[model samples]
Target chain A: MQHLLATHPRRRLFQLSPPATKPSREGVFFLPSIRIGLAVLALGGLGAGSLALAQEPPAPSPERSRELIRMVRQDCGSCHGLTLRGGLGSPLLPETLRDKPPDGLKHTILLGRPGTAMPPWKTFLNEAEADWIVAQLLRGFPEESK
Target chain B: MRKALRAWCWAILAFLPLLAWSAEPTLRGTGDLGVIIERSAGRVLIVSTSSNSIISKVEGLGDLSHASVVFSRDARYAYVFGRDGGLSKVDILRGTLEKRIVQGGNSIGGAISQNGRLVAVANYEPGGLKVFTADTLEPVADIPAAYGDNKLSKVVGIADLPGDRFIYSLFDADQIWIADLRDPKAPKVEKFSNIGKAPYDGLVTPDSRHYMAGLFGEDGIALLDTWQPEQGVKRILANYGRGEEKLPVYKMPHLRGWAVAGHQVYLPAIGRHEVLVADTIHWKETARIAVRGQPVFVVARPDGRQVWVNFAFPDNGFVQVIDTLSGKIVQTLEPGKAVLHLEFTPRGETVWASARDDHKVLIYDTASFAKLAELPADSPSGIFFTSRAHRIGF
Candidate 1:
């Protein structure tokens, strides 16, 4: 199963290609089943990558994740605006980030953008943690608890 | 014998009120007061400069990320500019918020007119500046920062001049505009374009004669003579960082933090771990003192004998004191984590520093370099003293 997941050329092509277009008329009948299969394949690919990236970033605990969220809202928010709308730094809203890839955003968080006010957070956050932050930012940041 | 004792007791009781009156503590005047910004909590802690103690806490300010405060002429009121564009008029004496207005979407800071009647805010969003009445904060004049082809530019480094005028640098357009507020309703603007690239922040000289803007895109400062507006702009220290490898700047060095002591002005060397000492008269770099980190605020004491400097992240915990005469790091002290700002008392007897991560404001004796006192704060950053009221563009 692992080998099949790793060597699947069609799945690799789907992952590398731009977002897929509408299915052809001949493939329309099997579209629903194909979609389900693709979803499973994508999940498998994520798992494979998780195992391959040198050392996987531990899934942040609930409390740790909450702290990270607050840090982004307050600390990063210093330059990025409290609402993350935009200030001295550019906006970080989901819409503004639709074109930005998740990996690229994560790299920016870890290494920081040179010649700008964005400082590298590698000392404070791990690669996986940065990935988590990018994911949350893309899906709309969480609000602090009252 | 009983009658005599009773008379004695009555006499002592009569003098008690007089003694009590003599021992009563005198009220602190507004001039002896100062404010410390609590960054995360959206609050300002009013403190007594004499005793170095927190007097009161004014709360409910919006976003204090890059917050700054300027005092009214009487020093009774404080105008706080928040990053979220909230302009709050805090009465320092009454320990209350008099008025607050959301002037724009984002703002770096603001300046009060020399006469203390008009307040001008430098805005990032919607890209313009808005002047308001100092007393009521009522909108007076709206100046859209449009450059070429109706392009709006974010305003930075808005400072007040001696002649009821305000000067500001356009961040995106690379221009400087001096607004004459002799008539608050209608300001006559004198624009100087193509001054420099990316004038991030600026400050007016203590004499209010020279207006210098720090350029981020280049390794120099743009200077304009307020006295000679027709001379256009001059670039100073153009090659200060030439042949040196530039470091990543995690934070922008504030030109307001540059200090003039004696014949020299101390400026934070951009993208370098040093403070450049430049001659005010010659406008040339004389020497540079290596520091622990990228210099943030290089402020001189009121007496002009010593200058204290803070650093950017990773080395923000340390502060170095430079003796102006020696042009060297005389002393280095670690106040605490993230020492964001430093402010001197009216007489320069004491300096107040805020350590944001440690949640404390440390007071140090200027002469002895000893810790005088520490006040607990919530992520404290900027320490502003009422003595700023006397300065033209504080």
Candidate 2:
């Protein structure tokens, strides 16, 4: 855990501040180092002074990105509305998500919000994929190609 | 004078054919007419059940990703409730949008009143139920789903009752409310609190006696006897998943497609690859039929001899049919990819299914299980028929 945190000092500070205030997230910090590394990869992918500094793992291929986009459009669209407008679930539009932090959003995608209808997608998605989804969502998700 | 009169008659007769050639409207009945939601295009295909074909298409409905249709009493007009809070009344016969109103910020679905006079919409944003006059889309009343302090709960599972009443469940508040609208200006609402965890969706029995809401936060359903609101909400099929580790649910199972076959009610079990069969007489679980995937919709044929089940993603491409008499998986067929919704013809002779990914609606003969026809639609989802106009809860 010490080595993982030392390697990503900026991310460790940013990620540790939230769990300090939130008692619910305290349990999540004590998990195995592998989970912490994955969480760091997910939350710290876009939080940097420089885009190059953001620790992005191997990017998905062009073909794989399309599948991920379709899954989010149709599967997540089931509750978020096909147009990403609100339905039973809140809207995923840029306007609705602009105020929310990308780190929290990625966490929610990986480990769903407890006591809500949102379910975790960790089984279907990895840390990088969830981070990629959050990045796309923040800047208006792309429409699926016909 | 006789020659002038004959000349005038000749002129009138000459203009009659010209008027006929200019434009003549086609008259038709709406009994067999229905609407299919083109989710991606924000359009609807006005279809005919008698001929099993698409008659025409109407467009300009905003954000139809989760659109639902409820027909007016005459069945000539369909009230389409859109996700972006647009309630459009479409003239199915003329294939035109008659009236539309963006009444809310985010709306889920709606139901027409028992007498077909009022339409009530369930909303998420600024959560509340709004009633409107069926004819002109005029606002009648607004009932906010307000709970403790200033918080509001998103309302779901709205259905019309025998009297001018609408029964719905509150997801955040964990309550079920029945609004009596006999007096449209003033609705009398009866609230039952602490029903259970999140009541995601609801359905009214064919007889209009019971209203059951499927719970997503727990392993049971909240059942309400509409006739006896005083009896309170009862938890049926509680702890059905006590021992098993509930699987990750990719899609939430809908309760609207609930099936009541003979004496048993077939329900889609949440996060489990099974359908729960309960005895309607005592409201007890009699059996649990294992299925291929997590069932989304479990609908019975009109005759109740067969119940068709559709699944969520991963297993969504396949559909299974259950024999009600034997309670066994009779047949399974791969209809198409991303099969979203299903609707049986009024008499159960045929069933129409919408495959969103394939962009086609597949028709099948229920008895022979043979593919009847395939009609092109733009990312189709729900298939609603006009026969729902006369039913209690659609």
Candidate 3:
């Protein structure tokens, strides 16, 4: 699991902060690492921070990629709508997901949104595979056959 | 005499064509017709239960990802609810699409009123319920599930009740609303906000006396007795897991597929690979039967003699059949890859299951546990039979 997390470029973003020493009245903990990371990036004057953070992961082989694409179109499509138009889950079309950062989408795919029907695919997919899916979704999703 | 015989032969030949026409089967009289949803291909295969053959395949309906169907009272027409919010009325006897309408941006499923006059859909996009005339599919009422400063909540588990009313669970708001469509133009809404947290899905019992909603944010289920609505909702099986960590829920358990056998109800334990048996009289967990994987649909046979269950992804290929009397898994069958849904024949003598990965629908004999036949499908999911016309919620 650790190895899989390392392959994700945005892993550091989630791991930036350490666990809170105490919980608040509402039982929610605030992460200070995110503020520190933002300060560091601002001081470095890196306007292309998002692009730098989205470092491409190791690509899957062509055959393996095709299999992953089919899984997304059929299995993932079960809830996301076969056409990616949205059903129980939100739409996955490029237009609907255009504003979402690629790295964020990758993180979501790896560690599903808690309290929702989305289940983390880290058990079934590697970080690299999830990155591939995010990239495909940003563009147009592939057809099931060709 | 020869000339007279020739004339008679010609007359008999002319009558032969009329005889063949009369011998053709009538659409309305044909019993046990069902529909198999081809999810990816946007088509539905109309199958005859008695012959176990494909009657016809209706096409052009769009985005059947989470498609569901409800039958008309006469069992002649099937109203298919597509994921793209396309409501289509299909004539089972004619094996053709009668009427189609795009009601919403995205819909999960729908229910037909007890009187068979209205069809209501639960939508997620705009977050509301839409009711339409059962015959013409005309818009009757639009009830936006608004709560707390005009915020909309996605509707789930909408089922028709006895009094021309529809009950649905709100996934986002964590409430249940009963919409009385006594007058198709205006519906009286009764909101039960204190039901529980994140009521994912719900279903009305076969007798239509109780409505139960499964909670996602908490353990246990919320129960409402329609006969005694003023008493409010009762929580049942509150500590099902007993503080133990639950297995990660791959997919939300669907209460619509829960089964009732005799005086007991069989339900899929959320996030767990077990089927929980609850007594209808006491509304308490009686027994938990371990199964192969996370149970998706724990459907009871028509006779309520046995219950069939299918699992979630990775373990989706296997199906387990349990004997209701003994509360034990009697047999296990592999119906191929990505087995999504199951439906039983009118008499519950046979079961039909769809394998999405294999692109085939398998039918098995319930009593003998034998493979009966297989029909080729395209990424099939839900198998709905016309017999649903007789049930409370389909």
Give each prediction's DockQ, rounded to 2 decimals: 0.21, 0.33, 0.25
Q: Which CAPRI tier for candidate 2?
A: acceptable
Candidate 2 clash pair list: none
Candidate 3 has a TM-score of 0.85
**Each candidate's TM vs. the true structure?**
0.84, 0.85, 0.85
- Runs of candidate 2 with Cα error greater than 4 angstroms are A1-59, A98-101, B1-24
lDDT of 1 by residue, B73-159 (tens): 999999999887799999998899889998887787999998889999998876888999999999999999998898889899888
TM-score, candidate 1, is 0.84
lDDT of 3 at B190: 92
The lDDT values for all models are 0.81, 0.84, 0.81
Better of 1 and 2 by DockQ: 2
lDDT of 1 at B116: 89
For model 3, give the TM-score of chain B.
Answer: 0.94
Docking level of model 1: incorrect
Worst 10 residues of 3 chain B by lDDT: B24-33
